[model samples]
Target chain A: MADSFSLMQEQYAKILQTYLQEKNEIGLYHAQQFSKKVLENQISPEEVVSLHLDAIEKFFPDLPQGARDSFEFLLEVMMGYGMAYREHQSLRDKQKELETEINVAANMQQTFLPKEIPSVDSLDVGVISVPASKMSGDYYHFVKDENNCIGVAIADIIGKGVPAALCMSMIKYAMDSLPEQRLQPGALLENLNRVVEQNVASNMFITMMYGSYDPRVHHFYYSGAGHEPGFYYNYKTDSFEELYAKGLVLGITRDTTFREYHKKVEPGDFIVLLSDGVTECRTDEGFIEREELTRFIHQYKHLPAQEIVNNVFYQLEKLQGFQLRDDFSLIILRRKV
Target chain B: MSVQSNVEVRTEWGIVSARQAGRNLAKEIGFSSVDQARITTAISELARNIYLYAEKGEIIIEAVEEIHSTGVKHGIKITAKDKGPGIKNIRQVMEDGFTTSGGLGAGLPGVKRLMDEFDIDSVAGEGTEITTIKWNS
Candidate 1:
């Protein structure tokens, strides 16, 4: 460090001498080149000022005390600037590290989702989950067991980034261990709530909606844990009804009970399950009402289940200026038989 | 005597600065470590709310003194003000498990729980201002 400082001092002195003698563009060009060299060596602005002062003192031993005092003040100002610049650089590095970790966590989260949406003879299903950021706090899973009961679960962690991703993995493993509960939406939620309460932090919680559709019975049994209400489209009434269930969010308590609800599905009936991102979509006006969301669904109800979700997502995405404010997850299960 | 600090909350760094300013004021006011943590946490939530929803805002931390019939009470007050798109439904946002940000829905309610006194004023398209105080007991 001392050797580089001395070398830089020598170069600075030479540039100063040339600038004072010629006072032309050639001297200015050399000064710029010297600055580039100093930057490459990571010499701070204060250090450069110090080197300049050294050169000035050497060149003029009888320089006025007032002139020297100004140099000292300039040195102090440069020192503060240098410190702030270094601090900013370190903060940028930390932010980059955080971004990389989130990307890795996002990739790990992708594996937790169902690789393929299980095809059911009686149920036409479609799902779309998009994260506003690299790491998603929203999670969804599909389980098709031996009896061919299609179990679907959508959950949102009350947090974001790495911690949410870790909590999701825990939920995924906990759900996988409960094969019997898959057919019982309320029971599944009850067991998952226990896992969350025991494992996760007190400040963090998760809201989830889980449901299973039995093709044979044409019944969809669902449960919710403080989640946003979903919509149930009735073919007979040609209207939508809210799917509401009252329960505390998971991780709040170990003994909280989630109530089970069911709806009979006719040939043209469908169930729309979604995270709050769909219903609370913000635009120039404000949050879109649930009725507006239902209208979007009704408009695209004639298309295939997947097409409907995709189109709804596009419309909402457009409303928000093509930038989602939160993690968006939507699922539609239409009875085709 | 009242000492105030202002932090402009426009980015992640702004949230950090607001938290630091709140902690400093809380410490100077002789708040216990636990209370100081709570104050800082509340400030963090408010500052983050501005960064996320409002895009830009200001957080002011002030040492406050209130006089009552019994005695003089010392406390710290924090005010977060923003001119971004204001909340359309203040009641819904204050609910414990209602969040549009896909977060833990603990934003405003959590702040309320941490502080002794809380108040919020918002106008759609105008802006929002939240004032909260925690008295040393």
Candidate 2:
């Protein structure tokens, strides 16, 4: 009995040292369990020595079975805490990196988009393009080429992101090169389609609406390459006219032909161009339909060109449940007398 | 609730068309609005290479496991292969302003800088396969 008591004392002292060395409060909690074992005669002198050895192994924090036992389990809990802290820190770092990439990409895409419509006499124009991501696949541009031909395009690339941005650049350059393309919508689409097919992949395609407006005649000649129809409203008739001609998508098949549509805008006449993002928009009700869109346009017909554009976008934003799933693009042009 | 999914797109040109297809693929990958954009951007660059540089390829996107021992990232992996003109000098082609066609030359190099792991395999008169992986925290 005397020998056992003395050995237990030594073991207890050793365990206390481990708790201090490792600053393991949980270890201290388990030390009480060791003490109880002795009081209950559950631990023998040999077992006391083994417990002391375990305490020492855990002081270095590399005890393999260190955490399996009641005493070692406490120290293991502390180790878990430390590891979890490090893991959280690493995760935060990665999140920051992704955010930075998105910011830069979004900014680059923004530069490619037009912030404001060009100020043209006798023409009221407003446009909005929202990307489902930081960048989107839908591209719209308003350009007055070197020949002073106002070119407007609403193109939907087969996919989204930086690739769409790259493709948008391609479309801009191709249209610029074909400066002499006037009142020739079919030929213009043919040239653009050929360029896209040869330059891009055969599977990749673009559905675009390309048009050149002649300020002199107030006439718009437009070509469709599998794009959505544009609406032209004539105030004189108090009705809506459509500019839709069937054409194959660019890069689909090289020899695909395009159809041309012409419309003369009077002083109160206006034109609306949009990507499928608008027409295909969905909400809780169901897929946004074409007739519903016409109703929305007519509802806002009283507003000026820019105001109508803003109002239409506002309605779509609310109706689509505030989610811009695909690239949402819209352009409203009013002919000023 | 936000949902994320992992996808693998056959590097066929037909599948890549239609913005909805790519958009659906993006949403499935558990990407945030911003991550979705980066993912799409990365996909665009790689897909263009498959179509423009090679005749065919495949792209893989994987969702990262919450706890990974191998330190693997939770980003997408895109691999593309084509049997057209193999890049002669990878180093030169990796540089900006270096393009086989009259383009921005932002395809390969641009994708490399966007991801965590970027690899390439090519032989003259054969084809080229490029792989890129991005990570989410």
Backbone clashes, each candidate: 1, 9
**Candidate 2, residue A41: lDDT:** 54
Candidate 2: give the clashing pairs. Answer: A122-A336, A203-B13, B4-B28, B4-B30, B5-B28, B5-B29, B5-B30, B54-B82, B75-B134
Q: Which stretches of candidate 2 lie over 4 Å from their true place?
A: A1-68, A74-92, A114-116, A145-149, A177-183, B1-137
Task: State every prediction's TM-score relative to the real structure.
Answer: 0.60, 0.54
Task: For residues A1-337, write the lDDT of model 2, one tens digit per residue.
Answer: 3336456656676767867878878878868787676746534233344455554664556755633355433432333232233333444566899789878877876776666666667677778788877777888877664555577888898777777767876776776688553546688789888889889866667899988777777888888998888888888988886768688889877898887777887888888899888888899877888878878888988777667777888898899778787788888878887
Docking class for model 2 is incorrect
- Residue A151 C-alpha lDDT in model 2: 70
Top candidate on TM-score is 1
Q: Tell me the lDDT of model 1 at A316.
A: 98
Name the runs in model 1 displaced over 4 angstroms: A1-43, A48-69, A180-182, B1-137
Give the per-residue lDDT of model 1 (tens digit) for A41-137: 8675666777888889999999999998787567645543454444445446668997887788788789889999999798899999998877788
Q: Which candidate has the highest lDDT of all? A: 1
Clash pairs (backbone) in predicted model 1: A158-B104
